[model samples]
Target: MQILLLGGHGKVALHLTPLLLKRGWNVTSVIRNPDHESEILALGKGLKGNLNVLLSSLADVKSAADAQKIIDTVSPDYVVWSAGAGGKGGPSATIAIDQEAAKHFMTASFASPGVSKFLMVSYLGSRKKQPSWMSDSEWAGVVKVNTEILPTYAKAKQEADEYLTALAEVRKRDPNASRFQAINLRPGTLTDEPATRMVDLGITPKGRGSVTREDVAIVADLLLARSDTEGWIDLVNGEEGVEGAVERVAREKVDAVVGEDVEGMVKRFFPEAGLKF
Candidate 1:
């Protein structure tokens, strides 16, 4: 499979690239800086796959022309949105990288004939409705999650996730004719701890929790390989080991195999996840 990744230097993307490479998949990473090229290369040093770099800034992808340029440059089977402003950049920066960039990528995917799937690396609170207790001004303010603004981050993600889910609805209604499919992955608070190789996949975990960045990458890897998989799913540290979760996910037969409706399709593919339109 040919995969294109945004945010090439990100912690999760760095881990994901090597895993995809080990599976012998052709990978193209769109990176803003040339300096990070070596790190990506180093990951694939002894791996079996080919790594290609496309130098482009996600923030600069604002127009159809920009979208077309990306489509033509990297004819990808799957596009992974892993890029973000890392919360250091203020709200404008977050809107640019997280919302606008993600929208442009979806547009670019539609324009690209080779692209089939779009995977979003979202967050735990992304789908939450704006709470009645929090006023607009208060919600928009920088409420920190660690050093990042929790509300701003969640709002940005919510907008992006909503847009993709809308597109997914249109695709599902006309699966054979739809241009591409999509899946939004919302993982809980992230930590830099080493790969746990275990995760809880659902709408929300048993409770609010955190997960290792590496474990999220592993889930992404499995989801990418399952073409029939679509829509949103949340990830967190859980009782099931990563290997077992992956096996269970892989074993679930999709609609093509079972002659089922869309709801059944989603339930079988992501039994633990909450279903959206």
Candidate 2:
């Protein structure tokens, strides 16, 4: 399999590249900094899969056409969006990279014939409504982050997730559209801890918790292979093995967006985009 991974220099991407390479799946990692090329290439040094680094800035990707060019060049079977502004360049930067860039890629993926799956690394609180399974305290914490702490980042993620979900619906309704599926892996607060290979994955919230970047990468790797799974998966550090958790979630259907219809969601989240059914 050929995978196009955006944000090659990210911690999660760093962990994920090795896993994909070990599986003998060729990966084309996109990074803005040329200096990181060797570092990423080293991860696949002795692995079966070939590694190629594409030096490009996601901020420079202005539209779907710009993103489609990259997708066409790579022609990957799977595309993973791990890139983010990391809350570094302010609100505009967050919107540009986290929201706009992500949507561009999603739109481009839909148009790309070679792309079959587009996986997004999103946060656990990337939704406007709280799930019924979550407790009051848990929902409050999520709201705090979305409304105050990382407001811009949270809003960007929320909109991006909504847009991707809407696009998935569009794909289902339109027979002529490309068959590429969109998957959102929403993990809890991230940490630098080692991989536990254990996680809680499903549609319901796992309360307020944190997960290791390594564990998230492991889950991402597994999810990429499980083509049967789609929609948003909420994850956190837990007792269940990663493989088992992923398998269980794959067997069960996850309605990522609840309390809102697809048409309403698209209209509310993307009023100006003019997304056609």
Considering every candidate listed, which one attains the maximal TM-score? 2
TM-score of each: 0.80, 0.94
Clashes of each: 2, 0
Off by over 4 Å in 2: 176-178, 268-277
Instruction: List lDDT for all candidates, in order.
Output: 0.73, 0.87
Clashing pairs in 2: none
What TM-score does candidate 2 reach? 0.94
- Write candidate 2's Cα lDDT for 1-277 as tens digits: 9999999999999999999999999999999999888899899988999999999999999999999999989999999999999978889999999999999999898777778899999988888777788888888988998888989999899888888988887677666665666889999989998988887777655556889999999999998987788888888998899898888888877655665466877666556653554
In model 2, the worst 10-residue window by lDDT is 268-277
For candidate 1, the per-residue lDDT at 64 reads 55
